[model samples]
Target: MRAASKKRGIEVTSISRPIKPSDFHDFDLILAMDRQNYEDILNSFERWRRKEPLPDSAPNKVKLMCSYCKHHTESEVPDPYYGGPQGFEKVSSMMY
Candidate 1:
C-alpha cells in the first residue's frame, strides 16, 4: 500500500491490517472505496452485530468514501490495479 501511495506521490507511513469486526466499534466512520467494498464492510459489521450488542446507530457508520468527495466525477473510485499510472494519480488527486 505504501508503494502504491508513493507512486502517486502520497506519503503513507503507517502499516495496514485486515479489516476486523472491532473496527466498527473503534472508528467513528468506516469508508469503502467502492460498492463491493462498502457491502463487504457492512456485511462484516452485520455479522459482528449479530453475535454482539451494538448501538442502534452502528448501522449508519459505514459508507462509500467517494460520497464525501465533491470534485470526483465518478460515484465509485476506480481501482488502479489494472489501469495506468494516471489512474492512480487521479485517485490520489481526488483523495487530496
Candidate 2:
C-alpha cells in the first residue's frame, strides 16, 4: 500500500514506535483506527491542551479513522476478532 500510494503521488507514514503528544505538531492529522484509540488520543491531547490550549483549527485535524473510511458510516468499526474473517471482509467490501 505504501508503494501504491507513492506511485499515485500520495505520502504514506508508517509509525513504528510509541506516539507522544509532541508528535502531533509534525503531522497534519492523527486518526485513531477505532474509538478506544481515539479516546487514548483525545486523553493525551487533553494533557497537552492543559498546557497549550488548542486553536479553533485543531478539532478539524483530530478525527477517528473510521470517519474517513468509506465502509463504516456509523462512527464505529465492529470488532472482527471474535467474528472472524467474514466480519473483516464485510468491512473490506464496503471500503473498496
Candidate 3:
C-alpha cells in the first residue's frame, strides 16, 4: 500500500487500525472497501448501539468506497493484499 501511494506522490504515514464506534461521531463518512467490510461496520454499529445511544445518522455514514468512483464501474475496492503489486495498483487507480 505504501509503495502504491509513493508511486502516486502520496505519503502514507498513518498506521492501520480497526474501526471504533467513536468513529461514527468523528468522521462525516466512513467508507468500506467491500461488502464484507460494509456489513462488518454495520454489525459493529449495532453492537455498539446496544451499549449506548448513537446518532440517528450513524448507519448512514458508512458507505462503499467505490460508490464514489467516477471513471470505474466497480462496486467495491478490491483487497490488494493477495493480488500483489497489480492488485495494489488496481485499487489505487479506482481510488484516484
Candidate 4:
C-alpha cells in the first residue's frame, strides 16, 4: 500500500487497529476499499455503537473509497487478486 501510494505521488498515514471510536476520533473520514471491506468496517462499527461509551452526537466518519473519486476515478477499483496485469492496468488507469 505504501508502494502504490508513493508510486502515484500520494502521501498516506496509517491507522492502528480501530477497535474503539476514540482510536479514529481525530480522523475526519474513513474510506473502505470495496464492498466486502466496507461491510467488515460497518459490522465493527455496529458493535461499537452498542458497546462503546461514545457521545450522543459525535460526527459520523465512514465512507466508500470510490466516493472520494473525481480527479479521475469514478468507481471502486475491482480487486485484482485473481486477474493479471491487464486488470491491474485498469485500476491504475482509473486512479490516474
Candidate 5:
C-alpha cells in the first residue's frame, strides 16, 4: 500500500486501526470497504447507542467506500491481502 501511494506521490503515513464507536463523534464520515464492514459498523453503533445516545444522523455518516467511486462498478473494495501484488494494484487504482 505504501509503495502504491508513494508511486502516485502520496504520502502513506496513516496507521490502520479497528473502528470504534467514538469514531462516530470524531469523523464526519466513516467509509466501509465492504458490505460486511458496513454492517459491522452499524451494529457497533447500535450497541454503543444503547449505552449512550448519539445523534440520529450518525448512522447516515457510514457508507460503502465504493459508493463514491465514479468509474468502478465494484460495490465493495475487495481485500487485497490475499490477492498478492496484482490485487493490491487493482484496488489501489480504484482509490482515485
Candidate 6:
C-alpha cells in the first residue's frame, strides 16, 4: 500500500499499535482517530491513573482528531473497515 501510494505522490504508512499508558505521559497531545478510539484511550487513561495517579490535568491530554479541523462536519472520524474504496478515500481526505 505504501509503495502504491508513493507512486501516486501520496505517502501513507501504517504505525498501528495498541495505545499505552506511557503514551499519555510521553506525549502532550494524543489524538484519537475515531470515537471508539477516543473512548478506549480515555478508558486506558483511567486505568493508568488508578494504578499511578496522573496530574489532574491528564484528562485534557486526549482529544478527537476531527476537533482540529477548521470546519467540524463530524464529531468523530468514521471507520472505513466495512466500506468500499470511497470510504477510505473520504477518511484520507478528511485527515489530510
**Highest lDDT, which number?**
3
User: How big is the positional error of residue 28 in model 6, measured in Å on the Cα after superposition?
Assistant: 0.8
Show pairs that collide, candidate 2. Answer: none
Off by over 4 Å in 3: none
* Better-scoring candidate (TM-score), 3 or 5: 3
How many clashing pairs per prediction, in order?
0, 0, 0, 0, 0, 0
Model 3 lowest lDDT segment of ten: 87-96
* Candidate 6 lDDT: 0.75
Query: What's the TM-score of every candidate structure?
Result: 0.79, 0.55, 0.93, 0.59, 0.92, 0.79
Which stretches in model 6 have alpha-carbon errors above 4 Å?
A: 1-8
Query: What are the Cα lDDT values of the candidates?
Result: 0.78, 0.63, 0.90, 0.63, 0.89, 0.75
Clashes of 4: 0
Q: Give the TM-score of candidate 6.
A: 0.79
Q: Between 1 and 2, whose lDDT is larger?
A: 1
Error of 6 at 79 (Å): 0.6
Stretches of candidate 4 off by over 4 Å are: 1-23, 55-59, 71-74
Lowest summed lDDT window (length 10), candidate 1: 1-10
Candidate 2 ranges beyond 4 A from true positions = 1-18, 48-59
Give the per-residue lDDT digits (tens) of candidate 1, residues 1-96. Answer: 455577767888786577887777788998888999888877777788888877667769888888999886778888876578777767777776
Best by TM-score: 3
Query: Which candidate order results from sorting by lDDT in descending order?
Result: 3, 5, 1, 6, 2, 4
Candidate 5: regions farther than 4 A off: none
Ordered by TM-score, highest first, the candidates read 3, 5, 1, 6, 4, 2
Candidate 5 residue-wise lDDT, 25-67, digit = tens = 8999999999999999999999999999787889999999999
